[model samples]
Target: MGRDFEAADHSAALIEQVQEAIAARTTLRIRGADTKAALGRPIEGRTLDTRAHRGIVSYDPTELVVTARAGTTLAQLEAALDAAGQMLPCEPPAYGGQATVGGMVAAGLSGARRPWAGAVRDFVLGCRVVTGHGKHLRFGGEVMKNVAGYDVSRLLAGSFGSLGLITEVSLKVLPKPRAALDTALEMPAQDMPCKLRQWRDAGLPITGACHVDGILHLRLEGGEGSIRTAQAVLGGERGDGAFWVALREATLPFFNDRRALWRISAALSAPLAPLPGQALLDWGGAQRWLKTDASVETVREIAERLDGHATCFTAGVADEPFHPLPDGLLRIHRQLKAQLDPHGIFNPGRLYAAI
Candidate 1:
């Protein structure tokens, strides 16, 4: 009963804050640890800290679902999942120790196993949010088959607080793999993509793949027998699992350079024409990270020509860090933003200037 009372009081406080902001026509920057402050266009407003509203609401290993408050740290959630021998399949990055569940979903950043496992949004089942009008609403459910209407829960993923304040999230979890192995092979940067394609077609259990500094690193996770067979077929010396973790966290030497970093998402079989800087390949050639001083137009043009989009992932080089949307998509975004935040008191101009 005391716990329920505390939760009710917290909710009332949050609603009051939102109502005051709305009444005053004051914009608010919803913050959860601020680990991803460097991402997207910068915004300035009254800081609405969600850190104090932290806790794991529920977890059922058998059901493979864990619901937690927005301010709950990723470390806490992962620890609980680990204890249950299950995991967040998306393998989100904890940019810092303060990384929160809300921030993870909002940023929508995935890790090395993304292509094989899934994305952050894929694991999201439902969420509770406070919209601009200070109305508390819940969209989605703990079960996967509860699909009824618009997937507003998943839509909050990667929204970066533009639409509303995500107060809680429900995520689908997966069991840990029975076995895992890491292997590396020396290969030319250009040849790595084709090799990755061949391995993928061969139906090997590849959870992660990256080519950096003239070395191709592959991570395989599954049964022990499959791991041995894949190692034999791939033919590379064993590598450290920490290597992949560093790669995912951007702590590797390859990511140490201070040049402008651009994340390019292209086809798995996309041909590689030598670009003007150091390159690191991940996502089985679908995601490429380039560190270069090249012009924004040059980088984007090359990516567009390859039938992919490039974003200024780390720095403030472009006016829009994300790919520009067409008129049709932009209209949908505007409509949704207006519906959820009619007064536009949420994180305004964080995603796009017009919204």
Candidate 2:
């Protein structure tokens, strides 16, 4: 909930504007449409909208690189890449269907295909960002193997705009799979924790797996034969609950209800750890989506016992959902933030208090 934020479309113009604001010691909350702005704690500053700066700048299919302004929508990028038979491989879930490319990277939100395809950070080729002092800087390169400097490109992926306001980004895309098959199993609700682990350890080529309500849904993608073979090996019937998988991604009901949502990420084989309330299985058993009436601390404690952490995937109030990091890690984060934004003007207090 940034109260005094302003939206800007031009990157160069934004740099000058933010620089002036920084010189005046005005804290700013950098964003793109505020789609996922509530992801972290609420900030007390001016909100800078990076939307209106949308569109693909350069797309070199031969090099598998697509560069675009930060405000570019994932839908637009995906549709264009789909026509070209290429994709952003990271499988970023469209948060409320309004998530901009910059928002996606800032939040580092990924879908079920993450373990196989890669995380959002992995696909990031490079980025041009505006620092706290309103200085525009570029990191990484269009080429994947280029490791010239501090690897600042990937660092900004999950920084949630705390490090800087990403103005332009270039990502590596991959050719779409030859075929895709959605399949499922009607396993009992209580049996999924074991079944999912068994499937993962059995080495089935499952691209996506989740147990919602009472049905176990799986998505298989590859060559036609490979998809069919994998489906048959998993012994799943053709699915009638494909939409449930989609619901898990955008979290239709949970988002609407504004329940205290908890995203527990743990080992795929982690035992059926007790949760304080209703839970849905997603990303196989590696990720759990919980809707609970308990306090945030209660949910976090449960995750800690299971050797995992809980994050507020989406909620109304701005509060810390993650456990406090150790002093050593905090030192590094503060140092980086200081170097990038000495005045702490970019998304101040967004991720952590001092980051």
Candidate 3:
């Protein structure tokens, strides 16, 4: 009864804050730890600090599901999972110790291990959110087989607090791999697509792959025997685990350039085109990060020709950070936003200016 009372008090407090914001017609910045404040378009609004409402709600290692409040820090969640020999398979980036699980899902930024393990959204099972009108709603479920409608939980993953405020979330977890190893080889940027294709076809245990500074780095995670075999097949030189961590968190010297950062998501089979500046290829060649002074039009044109889209991740070179959606898709997004947040009081314009 005492625990239930505390939970009720927490919910009431959050709801009251939202209701007040709605009453004043003031936009609320849905914040969790504030580590990702630099992301997305800047917003002017009263802050809704979620860190005050933090804790793990539940964890069942046998079921491979952990439910926690949105304010829970990523370190806290990862430590708990690490204790059980499990982890969030998506390998979400921890930009800092203050990074929150909500911020991870909200920003929807995946780490080096995305291609093999999955994305942050893929591991998300469900979420409890507060709509702009201050109504509490739950979508999806803790169990894997609980597919109902719309898959709204996953939709909210990359929404960046545009749709609603996520209060709690349940995620699917995986057991940590027994062993991991990194292998590196110097290679040209244009040659990476073909090499990655060959590796993918070879069916090795490559959990992470990135090409930066003429070096193709591959991470293999699995049993010791399999890693040894893979290392022999794809030999270059042994690499340290710290390399991948640096790449994931953008701490490497390659990311320190003073230029616009564009993230291009293209087909692995797409032919590599010459770009203006430094580039780092990740996700087995599907995701490429380019730091260049080139105009957004040039970058988007090249990406579009390759059957992909370019997003201006930082230093706004594009009018919109995300690629412009097709007419039909844009209509759907507006409709969904209207349905969930008719008042337009939740992180307004954080995603698209019109939304």
Candidate 4:
């Protein structure tokens, strides 16, 4: 649906390239639009760009299933979905660039609707991957044992291409809400969580919630009657819908400061504590974005106290931008990498140091 471009299938060439790289005993740095260049650790390998192998392979608006090549841009997919009156409810961010479908899945990021809807992996139904063995394989999507995309397709969502080359993917979609409204309330960060709980219990069609600088922003979505009822219950001024978009893209004024920004994710009920820096609560207090010069150790310590982990968003601030995995879990990661990439040819050390 993007620009009415003809469907291009470069799987043959892509597989051949993988085979050549494997035979030559070299590594591969998988890139799709390279919009998240500063996200994870840098890799050293031959670039395997997936931008040319583009187009939607199959799309049935009625079935709510879409299959597209990795090279398809997010904007393109969204535009097509928009025409069909549907959307990817996870609301993946474009990061102010031409973010590709593969890159969005690889990053496994979700927007303000994440806590209400679900994460990227939740919508992935299947994937076509080029393994390090140079074999083209398919996983999930009416497969054996894996239900609800619990197999390789879901794992690759946040794998950052460390597992293998994602050539194509199938995702489930949802229809647009019938009605929506944004509301704002001036309340302390500490009290917003309790208020959100009350709304949830009362069955208020809450979809997105974020708090910053004494303002609690809430989005109501559902039937028109529900919206009207929730509006009266909320009793606040009309809020700016652009707030969510700006926050999702990190273009908000809060992110303008030149300091290391840390994303702290804890339980939804985690107590609000005064961080050692400026903090904005999002996801109904499930995620805290902190902009501070605090040492990595100190920031992580605070996160751990809340039974959560902190990931550095700013590049070069920490060697490992991801949270360290437990020894048992880390061993599994290494084993997975070894199984999929026997020659260690795919984005080595991109996710962790050992793998």
Report the number of the highest-lDDT candidate.
4
Give candidates' CA RMSD values in order. Answer: 2.5, 4.8, 2.6, 1.9
Write model 2 residue lDDT over 1-355, tens digit each, in one string.
Answer: 1111222358877887688778898888887867765577788887787787777887878788888788887777787788789988778877555678998899888887887788999999899998876778888879878685679989998898889889989999999888887776788666876766686686666677777666787877778887777767777677654554466356545445547777888776677666777777776677888877778777877777778878886645436745567799989999999999898888887888877
Deviating ranges (above 4 Å) for candidate 2: 1-9, 146-149, 189-203, 240-245, 248-258, 314-318
Q: Which segments of candidate 3 are over 4 A away from where they belong?
A: 1-9
For residues 51-135, what per-residue lDDT tens digits would candidate 1 score against the true structure? 7777788888889999888888888888788887999889888865579988999989999899988999999999999998789
Model 3: per-residue Cα lDDT at residue 175: 94
TM-score of each: 0.95, 0.90, 0.94, 0.96
Residue 41, model 4: lDDT of 82
Q: Per-residue CA lDDT of candidate 3, range 1-355, in tens?
A: 0121223126567888888988988888888877767666778899888876777888889999998887778888888889889999888878765788778888898888887778899999999989976899999899876566688899999999988888889999999999888888899877877777787687678888888889889898999898888887898889778888798778899889989888899986787777778888888778889999988788989889879998887845667788888889889989999988888888888877878
lDDT of candidate 3 at residue 34, scale 0 to 100: 75
Best-to-worst TM-score order: 4, 1, 3, 2
Best by TM-score: 4
Runs off by more than 4 Å, candidate 1:
1-9
Cα lDDT for residue 292, candidate 3? 93
Which 10-residue span in candidate 2 carries the lowest summed lDDT? Answer: 1-10
